[model samples]
Target: MFTKEKEFFSILFEAVSEGVIVVNTQQNIVATNQSAENMFGYNKKELETAPLIQLIPKNYHHNHHTYVNGFMKKNESRQMGVGRDLFGIKKNGDIFPVEVGLNPFTVRGETFVMALVVDITLRKQHQDQIQELNAKLEQKVIERTKELSEAVNKLKEVNAELDDENKKRLKAENKAKEALKKEKELNELKTKFLSLVSHEFKTPLSGILTSAMLLSKYKLEEQQQRRDKHIKTITDKVHYLNNILNDFLSIEKLERGKIQYNPSQFKISKVVNEVIYNANMMLKDGQIINYPENIDNYSIYQDEKIVELALSNLVYNAIKYSSENTVIDIKIKQNLDSTTFIVEDNGIGIPEKDQKNIFKRYYRAENALLTQGTGIGLNIVKSHLENLKGNIYFNSKENQGTTFWFSLPNKYQTKL
Candidate 1:
């Protein structure tokens, strides 16, 4: 009966998936399960009665001995490697992460420890990957915030210079006071812009962070769809943030008179096709871009980049503010000396009260308050067109639709 019982215990020990190792007071591994043998790349004959240090890395031998001695003295059951990383070594001299639980026992007045060991290499890798991702995201946020803060500080310095100039013009007291008032108003507007920037950046960043965290949790092959979803979210948010930064850069350049327009001859069809192709990606469900009819023959002599930017901004805005299944019409008309491009959308239209300030920097219609926009795209477009001797105008009614058209000289003549 005793032999049968011993066999049953051996069978049960071998059945455990986790590696089990039994070490005697002398720190020799007196017994181990099949799992333990396989885990450490050893056989029963080689592992039994072997020094426990053989299964541990050379650097950890001293600490392992000390820990073994302390545990023997306490003679209690507890987990090992608490609050720290633990590792194990294989017979082939390969090191790997591990989790170990120790239980003290005695047979015939001889104390021993039975350690339940688990290989945690995969878990460790996942944890390290998450930490790296988090660090990268934090660094990106820090850099972007620093850039915006520097811009604000530069504005402040400019305002200070203006204040000094106003003070020196004492004879124009009324004008000086008016200038200070305008400065105060401008500062308030800056404050509002900062707040808007924070909100716009924070919302997408939070989404990105959340998606990243969720993406790490899905590791199975069947979870590919979920992973793809989070990846797309990250991609889209990054793109949006990039566009916002571009808008900020454009604003800075326009203010500093740094933009240099280079005109060239290009087919208008090429620009229109490119814009439509990009817009197709951002289209809502059931939405379609109706291509302008017979525009392959049309060509223009203008700054291709500027024209592309303006057209892309208008088309993207039309897609953004419009509903699913709605059509955005791009109508082109060439006249005697000028060509006009019209973007008409049957979406949420601008309020009548907001029409006058539609092209003003940082102004948004009341109905568009909920939309994701910096309200600077139109302003930038308007500035670019006006600088090139072009004009932009729009017609809209609340809840109906908006039609925006801009005219450029057919053959732009460089002022000599």
Candidate 2:
């Protein structure tokens, strides 16, 4: 019956897929299944009585004795090396990874250790392959990242270079535009200056020459009245020429920054009466200039001469442009902060297209070509008034009338 039970167990152990290795307390292999033999590269029934160390690597023989003695002393059954990997040796001196479960039992009053061994060579090889592939993949990713970083750096450098170039190009363009504008302004000044000198001098010189020639014919003492008329005409022409020269001189001083401005407190009505008295000298037949009644007592603190020049220019324009029997109205309005001077005339009004350019240097309205003017009065007045912190604007309708309004800040400082 004992033999029958042993045969039954051997058959049962042989059917297991894992190798069943049985060892005595002395660590000698007492029994091994066919699976154990096959796992260690052994033939059938060839592993009996072999020292268990023979199946371990030569380097692991001393450790195996300690492990077996510890296991026997502990008298507990468990897996070998629970938290670590295990290694195994084959009959042909080959080493491979393994997993081991140990069982201890007393069979017929003898102690024995049963080791359940699984040859995990293929699993270890697959793990090694996976680790190698992962290492290669990691290296590739690092290289690719480096290349992308380099590319991004290069793109940034290129963009920086492009921005610098764009800024330089914009600066060059702005410089060119400024240069062109200055050159155009210079050319315009030259052309208009020549035109003004030619027109102004030619008319006055012709008048003086004509009057002198007529006065030469009236040399007899009885022609005194006729000679006096010619003398008066000559005097007026000389005065007109002198006024033109003064306008040119003012422009030169303005350009050279040499004009001196003096600010003082002056009564508005005083300035008004003075300007109206002078403007009355140039009034035509049946024409009259009417100022508002009871002018305000506001005392403006500003360059009184500039205000006079501006007002004189406006009233002079009104008297020169209007027809006979037309009434020119001078209106004055004062706010708390500013003073307004309005000169309204029923005259040959400015053309719509000509009004915008009326204040430009040497600009004359086409309708006023026959009139006696050098076209410098309004521009000079405008510049002087601006220096005094004032502004001028006008309203006009063709063949109807013209109204010019200029404003002055009640409080201002002289700009030297």
Candidate 3:
């Protein structure tokens, strides 16, 4: 029965997870379990004489001694895992996290301290791993912030470049506009110079031509052919000079708003015939003039002189711009309350982009630059037609042909 009781108590002490040790007030270990021997790296026989301070790290030995002395003086119990971090030194001199509990007891007038110690190394390792991960996460966040800052800076640089490009574009556009305005002023000056020269020369030129014609009547028979040739030269020169003078004078009057319109009744057929006859004089040898047969004998109320000038300008332009031996078509028709005049030509047509400004003063189609023109012909025609409450329009295809149309009121038309 005694062996059974001793075996039961030994089994109970050895089975405890905590290492247990009992020490006297002198700090020498009096009793210990198998767990305590294994925890402190001491055999049961060695533990009998071992000092309790042997289980403490060298750095913590003095403090532990002081605490134990104080606890013994107060005769109180102490708990572990509350006041400070506690660690123990193993036989291998390796330090490990631990929790220590102390209980003081008196039996038979002998004082002893019961100590319970647990290994906490696994918990401490877990805490350390979490701390390490948190530090790594914080570092990653800092790197990401740096990347974002760099991206924002690059975006700012791009925006700056765009702003600079916009400024340059605007400057280039302004410079181009200024250049266009200066070119327009220069063209106006050239037109004025041509007008002045033509005006000063036309009167003398006409007088010379007339005198030459009169001289033709009384000529030596031997020199008669020479006289005829000279007369023809003078007439041609006068005719060319008259055309130049007329273009200039028309532009000047239109600019000064001095064109007078006298609307009157005129035979449409007679006017059409006269214009056709004049146009034929300038046609190439094989070029044909097609006129509508039997145009309506409608008496149109409009400025006869202005209408005739406008028609002549259109026919002359058609002949000037077309290839040699090409056909020019003229048609006149009477509508219910209006008269229509159409001039069609197979020529180098105005470009689509330039057609809008074709009627503007001083504006010429790019294709018409080689032709001798002041660019004021269509502008004058538009003004004269407006005064008579008429409308004029044109259709053209580049490299194909052009067709121009004008509609005048058959009678006196009101404000359009």
Candidate 4:
């Protein structure tokens, strides 16, 4: 019965998943189960007289000996699984991972240690592979985070650059605006200076021209006749200079707010006739003036001097620019609300691009450059019209000629 019980216990030990190794107090292996033999790749007979260290990895064997000695000194049951990296050696001397449980037993007054070991190689291998995969995943996360940070930094840099560019552009635009304003002021000053110079020179020039022209017609000796002819040439030059000066002076007075208006009831036709007579003196040879006969009886209320000056400027400009022998038409149309004066001439018309600026002080068209002018005639006319609470407009085409029309409100008669 005891032999049968022994055989049953041995079979049970061999059936266990753990490898069972029994060692005496001297640390030599005395018995081992079939599982132990298989775990270490040893036969049952070969395990006899083997030291426990023989199955341990060489690096761990020394520390294991110290632990076993401590256990023997204490004479207490001590566990081996805690705080250790367990290892076992195969019959071929290959070391692998293991888990060990040690238990002590006293049999017949002799102490023995029973070590239950489990092969943990496959579990450890799976754990290592999992760790490697986790490490790779962590590395990828770090790389992605770095890339995102770089992209955000780049966007911030670009935004800062754009803001700087916008500020620069705004500064440039402000500078350009300031420059344009300065240019405009300079232009106004130039116009004022030219006007002043022309005014100061006109009166003496007109006197010299009139005197020379009168002297030219006198009966004189041969030497005197030659002198008279020279004087006449000077007269012509002075007359031309006087006209330019007059235009400038008129523009200056208008721009300087020095022109005064004395409004009164007057015959509009008389003013028109007087302007036509004055303009005839400057007309080119063979130029004719045509006036509307019906205007003789029309009356208007306005500043007579200012209106006459305005009409004279327009009529003179028309005759000066028209072709010789071309007929200029002057017409008057009176309505219940206003009076319209139309001056039409067969003159070289203003270019389309220059027409808008024609009334601007000192602005001259490209085609009108050869025509002697101070570039102030239309500006004077515009100023006079504006002062009278009237307005002027014109139409022209290149080479086709021009017509100017202005209207004064009849209500001014009561207002004045």
Candidate No. with top TM-score: 2
lDDT for position 271 in model 3: 82
Comparing 1 with 4 on TM-score, the higher-scoring candidate is: 1
Pairs of residues at least 3 apart in sequence or in different chains that clash in candidate 1: none
Worst 10 residues of 2 by lDDT: 1-10
lDDT of 1 by residue, 209-262 (tens): 999999999999999999999999999999999998999999899888888888
The most accurate candidate by lDDT is: 1
State every prediction's TM-score relative to the real structure.
Answer: 0.57, 0.70, 0.48, 0.49
- 2 or 3: which has the higher lDDT? 2
RMSD of 2: 6.6
**Candidate 4 local lDDT, residue 233:** 64
Q: How many residue pairs clash (N, CA or C atoms closer than 3 angstroms) in each of the candidate models, in the order given?
A: 0, 0, 0, 0
- Model 2 regions more than 4 Å off: 1-150, 219-224, 414-416
Q: Per-residue lDDT for 269 in model 2?
A: 84
Better of 2 and 4 by lDDT: 2
Decide which is better by lDDT, 1 or 2. Answer: 1
By TM-score, the candidates rank as 2, 1, 4, 3
- For model 4, the superposed segments whose C-alpha errors exceed 4 Å read 1-182, 185-220, 223-229, 232-246, 411-416
